[model samples]
Target: MFIKLLLQVVYITVPILIYYALIRNNASLKRYHSILLGIICGISILLCMSFPISFETGYIMDLRTVPWMISFLYGNISTGIILTIIMLGYRIFLGGIGMFVVFIAYSITLLMILFYFKKYSQFSFQHKMKSVLTLTFINSLLIVSSIHFIFGFSESHYLLFYTVFTFMQLLLTWLTVYMIETFRENDRLQLEMQNSEKLYIVGQMAASVAHEIRNPMTVVSGFMQLLYQSDEIPLKHKEHVKIMTVELERAQAIINDYLTLAKPQADKMEKIDVKEQTSLISQTLSSYALMNGVDLHYHIKSDENFYTFGNPEKMQQVLVNMIKNAIEATLNKKAVTISLSKDNEYIYIDITDQGVGLSEDEIKKIGTPFYSTKEKGTGLGLSVSFSIIRAMNGQIMTTSDMGKGTTFTIKLPQY
Candidate 1:
């Protein structure tokens, strides 16, 4: 009987190991994995039930209830109900003197479990163990009582069968409950760490693009702005001026953000004033925004002392990319705003734009190279900005809606 119990226990552990290894984390098969678990548990239960050891001339027993109880303990109501039906039919198919008793016992237990499926599912592990203990006792009592009346089993035989069955069921049920919870928690943590890795990669790519991109953008924008501002420029060419000046400034912003992500910082790092920096960047780009039918607003809610430890050049780079993205995102809206504030450990930069917004999927992949919503976008701008901010020991977070707009918050640790 002890050896039989050990073999029955394998039915529980083997299926669980197979499930966690092959089905649990496989996205394509995950949707139906629970239903698949129910089927495996049913097979394990049936295998044990059919091969029970004979306890007496009129009494027999097995650890089949352990898997059945585990199914309900795991609280899969629909699957449990389906399996209960399968068990009921199988018991009737193997009809005999003691079979009626097993049928009565299982039916009573299963009906109560089905009725309280949700309540049982919400139970703490300890509560579930206690409830299953009580239910298992009742089921054993019903089966033994029926055995005594119908097949004339002696008291000693009844005691021996009841005690062993209940002990095995309770022990296996508790172990099953504990293991499943651990698997779920592990899966959640793994997902979070994967997201953190993507941002880290962005920071790496920035190192490669440094000096190669930034120098050319600065020179081009400086020349274009100088030309765009000339009084001799023809009236018919003003629209082209507005487009060229705004776009050049926008390009510089994208490259700066990209570099921060690469974790390479050669620019002078010091405690720089946030208000002074925004004023300089905005002054340079205001005409570019005007040409694109948008207004640039720099809202400095923090005082002059609101400073962060970062390269001044890189700081302006992220701001430019943010403002440029805002201008493009502005559909019917006319204003793009960059706000600044600070605390003891971090400086917060909020760039809010009124333009075409991103969908839920696009939001998740915001910093990926070559993934963009715009027709001609290379998708490296925001991704590079993310790298630059990360390189400076800062973080970038975004929030958006379909028709509303997007707001990006860049947080840098206070120097």
Candidate 2:
């Protein structure tokens, strides 16, 4: 029993070893460490399967209860299946094939059923109760009935093994529940830490944007005041006035973008139809895309409304940032396309640019506040948009290749 339990524990230890290396501090070493650990675990498992198991004639006490409990405590169905198969293979080779084979087959079936139930329902009270009761009853009936009908074993011994197995199964279930809960708490805390760090980065970007836009805006404002004060200016120099007016507007637009980044008003969230919002933003930005020598396009997959609860203005801001980025990224290409689709209760908008896409290093630094490849870029645009989308329970994913192009996919929950 001790040897069998040890083998089961060893089988279950593989994922933990891989997980430890996968989460190493140096990401460059993570893949190498994980691969090495996995190989070691695989070899160990294979060696364990080659060991011989011999049963004493007519009445060796059944240690079936031990493996049953161990499998449940581990909670990883794959580990349980592997341990059962390996142990059974060894027993079969030693000529303990008859009832041992049946036992191994039953363990695999139980593992599969438990896994299916858990996947469909998770760890709710009802799920746990159902799993426990089903495991207990099915295992008890199989042991008792099989010993009587097939193996011709005694009732007293069968009852003893049945009681022991039940106890082990119960213990295993409790351990699994506790481990799952502990892991979930750790994951929740880790996610919180990551979010806090992202928020800090966003705050820094906001400060940088304010500093960058303030001076240019002030100069533009002063020039506008000078033009207003000059009543004696000649009408022949009206082109100069037009240039000044356009420049001032551009400065104001920059300032506005900064202000929008600094203050993301979440209170304005409403039931926003994604299709309508994207359509409107596409129309509004069409002229800008054309001026920048890029054709802007929108393709909606569904004619029906794709609705989500968010601030339409905020969503529009996100779309504009993406479209503008696409336009700026395009070099020889003449067009950018925004594709919208819905699946699995998510509304997805993918913006693609046909320019020189981001390099591997650039892609890694993306959404990190103030990181930019553009010469004059403030770099707050995507970072601010990322925060806004996340606050709204959405995500922005990017894929880019150096010589090809870039695609930014925005996924938001649909109502």
Return the top candidate by lDDT: 1
Candidate 1: C-alpha lDDT: 0.71
lDDT of 2 at 348: 83
Worst 10 residues of 2 by lDDT: 52-61
Worst 10 residues of 1 by lDDT: 116-125
Prediction RMSDs, each to the true structure:
12.6, 9.1
Tens-place lDDT digits, model 2, residues 135-253: 65566566556555667756676666556555544554455444444554575457556755865665567567777777877887777667756877776565677677777777676
How does model 2 fare in lDDT?
0.64
Global fold similarity of model 2 (TM-score): 0.56
Would you list the clashing residue pairs of candidate 2?
Answer: none
For model 1, what is the error of residue 279's alpha carbon versus the real structure, in angstroms, after optimal superposition? Answer: 46
